[model samples]
Target: MTLVYFPSHFKRAPAIFFFAFFLFTLGVTHFFGGSVSLLQAGESKAGLPYIVKKGDSLGEIALRYNVSVTAIKKWNKLTGDKIFEGQRLRIEPFPLHSYTVKSGDTLSEIALASNIPVSRLRELNKITGDRIYTGQKLQLVNDRKRTEKPSVHVVEKGESLWDIAKQYDISIAAIKKRNHLKTEVITPGMTLSLKEVPEEKHAKEKTDEEDPELFEYKVRPGDNLSTIAERFDVAVSLLKQLNGLKENRIYPGQTLQLRPTSLDEAVHVVRSGETLSSIAFKYRMNVSDIKRINEIEGSKIVVGQELRLKGAKPNVYIVERGDALWEVAQAYGMRVEELKRLNGLTSDRIYPGQELQLGIAPARPFGTYTVKKGDYLGRIARLHQMSVADLKSMNNMKTALIYPGDQLKVTPFLQQGSEWLKISEINWDDLMGSSGGLKKITLGNGPYYGSRPMARRQNNRRYYESARLSLWNTYKRAQKLQAALDRKIAKMGRLSDCLNGWHIVIDPGHGGLDPGAVVANLDGNGDKVYVVEDEYVYDVALRVYVMLRLHGADVTLTLLSPDHLIRHSDPPVQTFVNEKNEVYNSRAFNRGNSRSHWPKGGRNGNLSRRVAIAENAFKNVPRNRRMLLSFHADIDHSSPNVPLVLYYRNRRTGRPDRASKQFAKAIQPFLGAGTVIRGQNVFVLRNSPADISVMLELRNLAYTDHAWALRFEELRQRDAEKVVRGVVEYVKGKG
Candidate 1:
């Protein structure tokens, strides 16, 4: 028997292979009788299969197949430099095909013919569009078969109709048609069809143009049902019917429907002492026409009876006291010329109780707008070139509070000329001084006067002088009192005083499954060991918590220990298992009040849990007296060796809270001379419920000095003391 000694590295090879080789050596070759074959170097092409033979190593086989040794090893699953005879190996890379474009062949058609995506075809040939020349050689990669059937996609939060259509490489019109969506508003969790519809089907789809104009009108401060109906050229009854309004009462910013009139009919309410001829004359129609339309037997009409007018009728306004023709025209959102033409008047003249035609007003130029997330009155006003006060007035809003899905009227009636006085140009100081400084005060002798008053009362000049002296003394006393109050406030703002009754929540960043930033170091035995960020921060957090508690602070810790394990009966505890087969305590990760269950457990779940824990801790405490301090360590080698105190500012206002900034500044000195205190929008800081939320990146773990300092208990204790000192200072200096 021929002895075949395999290398030591190949000792872990498959047992079946060794058995087959052993049988082959014993001349029992029936199993591989015709399987063993070889490909010559000049006979094989890339991606073709080749059989191995005796005396052939991976390098030799790769050379024979005109491929790289790495490729050969990868294709055959060879762990080391070893191979067996009769083993089949892939000697080539993926194949490519070159196709000449034929007549009437588009890029999409060609891709479909080869079962490839058009995107892949374009990428292979660097083609920008479908304008491919006939007979042009286009390179095509042999990719996986494309799916011909339609797919379904569930809508996620923050996704719009345009976004979904773009993601699927389809048209928005096709999605709308398939889903039968009348509007572009799609809610989260709604299932949407992503199937590409044919051009013919798209042509038959209902479009926005075919739908009636249905708009939402926001009630302005001075708006009523009559004004809204007149503005949109619809009847007040129609507005009430569409909006389901039982009464004409509407508040500012209240949304109302401005739907099209059904069947092109207008309803008219008969007033007292009104005849059919007079009504017809007011509507600019013949008396017989009105009678026939209303089915009247004679010229008689009942008061408060309803009348239906044929076709469209112009909105009428009963001229009120002090109303002019021009003023009435402007108030109804019409030009003076248009009003006269519609009313067939010879000149601009109007009087009280006279009906004036305000013709169907033109469609509002500024259309209605829906409130979205992060929308406020100030923002909406700025976008539409109006003032917040005007927006509130137009919407009849008593306050600035607006929620998403609330409709607002963007367009307000533009008044002709100056409707209100311009006071910004007036000099207020001059006016106040010229008005003789309001009135003068007089002091009377009372309990402070002694029994020895005997002089006669003085003249007017003496009395005025005495009054001025008394006034001066009162002003001086007021100034002194204010100064005393200022001094008291300053004394109370000290760090110790501030922390005395404050509820401070400390969040130790990363725990359990999340190691945060990690670095490798050598132990005494020269063995590699990992230094985890969460461990160091947790140690520091415990020290800070103890220090704050000693300082009379009501402290709450988000993560109580490194292992995150909590007692079974501990309130508000989240239970989880760590990588070391150890159980730990954590908060149940939740986004909102309703989402209590954890979804897609992993890094995301851990972070959400951390935030939830902090938020819950904060909520149980008083809002005004709460503060959150999150501790973390950085691992950036290139970052400067310094501590960082980060706080969040409102994105809309673009400024951090004054107290938060003061707290950061107070803690900076204790952290070190190189410490940085800045405003940033970190997740924890932004979402924390505390009045003051700040994050402290203790030190750079990657730096040798910082890393070495963290290893020693004494050094970490000293650092924790410094942090406590900073917190004390921040609280004391809160004023």
Candidate 2:
């Protein structure tokens, strides 16, 4: 009497027809959209074997639990809504279909709904830790008879033992133990004994390949198999097969067995054709040491196994009773500010026994100076190597207030990117060249800015060139910043001819239920305020759209503002928007898509719908003429020094598109010199129709200083302008 749920698209129409008829007979009718309406009721309660009290009816119970009356009736096989006291009913679902993990899904949540213990769930699935991928599959029931079903996998043409074991997410040692094979030799038509397979997929006559049907899962991180499958429009069950994951449980290696490893630094993931000796050779460590470190009994290793290399130590330190951040950082040859930043500490406070991550940052980028009596911002700026602005920006200072014992950061070597841009973005070299032709009597003694164009026009081009020499002498060493100031000579076309009618889609990552990287901060009034990912990201994206539109490019924003244009300030007015007001609107961006096409949902549904919007906007448009820039503020993983940028990973070869790579490089210099360009198989980039697409994590919001900047319009505008400027440079470079 267990009910089968079908996904949206009206799957199994005949079953749904009978279900509709059954509901009609019960004097209730229901409608469904986007596949299974039962999923809307959410996962079933783990509660089962219900002891029905007096006056309890199936309809009332269903209403209370937000489940369908039809589901309740079918689950109990009740002929009617009638019930009696002491009637033990099976309330939870019987395990049948495998559950695919999605973004933001937790194992405890899944286990509770499935009415199973967390420990038993781990044993049944064979996965350690809560790290499950989207599209991962999970087996819910504990039926030993399911494993007794001769779950043999027939060797395919040119298949290896490793391949078969990995395909089934079983251990090769377990296979060898089960089959009693000493050697790794096998032939076509030979069958391998697999440790696990679902009971429904086992067939005596079918000694063919792996089962066609499988279940994947959603995970907390959202970067799991289910999300991967959802992004690529492929079956997650198949990806599990590819990864040698059965029931969404990943063995240490796809085919080989591995001993448990500690959460320490210097772990190596075993690849195909690698053994202990090969891994030892790669890391230049002894094989005996490798075995001892990982606690392996033999030299045998498995593919995808995480082996701790020898002599590797844990990258964490336990705070002692007398240890302060300054003392600890100085002891480790690191800066105090960096230590605080790494641990996300807003104030310089420490407690004993608290663990801190020893980040891979090389000796801190900036030096710190302790404040003395009668010290002020101007005196400190001159005394230290950095500017007053740099000092204020780095410490998130609202005013020039400094205490006697305050440890202020001095970033002379350009740790703060925005302050450096303010000084270096001027055309210093061009000014040096023009200064040679200036008449001696034409210039004044004061510093000159070319802001007044009318005066220059009236003076017959003789104005301010003398002051250029004054400017030149002050900034003669500007060429040292050539790494960041690349493409200084390139023309950015005209403001009105941005790629001659290019179509751009600016997607602000995370919305609604996915608040993304939330941080509690304070506003200018010294009142508590919240900084959220969706709010600031939308403002940045909105700025990019406006800047691109001014350059005569067609721009589309995947999200709309409920507060309209009030969200984006021109002269940097609004500081922090705690509201999550950006809603999905396909028709709002491009006219081709309809308003009703997007459904109101949360979690990963928001991501998929953005990709759909990009695909629609670029339909029939030339691939080169379209680009997608997904702006997401990173927390925890981003580097303190530079922002993170990534392009799409090709599904087959695992390489980024040539055009996308070019686009990524063009914008990277503007973000910072050390900004890393990596490849992420993110759903939006992997699935977008546009060929040139990139996701930019503009800043590390994990640091309070960085998160504090997002609250103000000035910082957001700075981020947006740099991004738009980089795009223009990319277009110019292509030309």
Instruction: Quantify all predictions' global Cα lDDT against the true fold.
Output: 0.48, 0.49
**Off by more than 4 A, model 1:** 1-498, 523-527, 562-603, 650-654
Candidate 2 stretches with Cα past 4 Å from truth are 1-386, 389-496, 522-528, 566-577, 588-604, 638-641, 650-653
> What tens-digit string does per-residue lDDT give for candidate 2 at 543-573?
6765575565777667653322313222122
How do the residues 1-735 of candidate 1 rate in per-residue lDDT, one tens digit apiece? 000111111223222222222211111110110111111111122244566678878876654332457767776787898777887766653222456676655665455333345687898889888789988988764334423322344454567888777656678887887655679998754555454334343235343222112234445577788766654444565456445457888776455545322111133434333467545644556888776654455575543244555522346654422234544554455777787677654434332223456666764344367897655554455334343444675677876689999999774322323432211222222211211122212112111111111221111111111111222232233233323323332333122333677888888776533546554322222222334566567667755765565556877666432111111110101111122111122333312222223221243544555556656666657666888888888653223345667788677776676577767755664564335566777777877778887888886654333443454343455567667767766666554
Once model 2 is optimally superposed onto the true structure by TM-score, how far is the C-alpha of residue 105 displaced, in angstroms?
A: 22
Model 1 / residue 478 / CA error / Å:
58
**TM-score, cand. 1:** 0.30
User: Model 1, residue 202: displacement in angstroms?
Assistant: 58
Q: What are the candidates' C-alpha RMSDs?
A: 35.4, 22.7
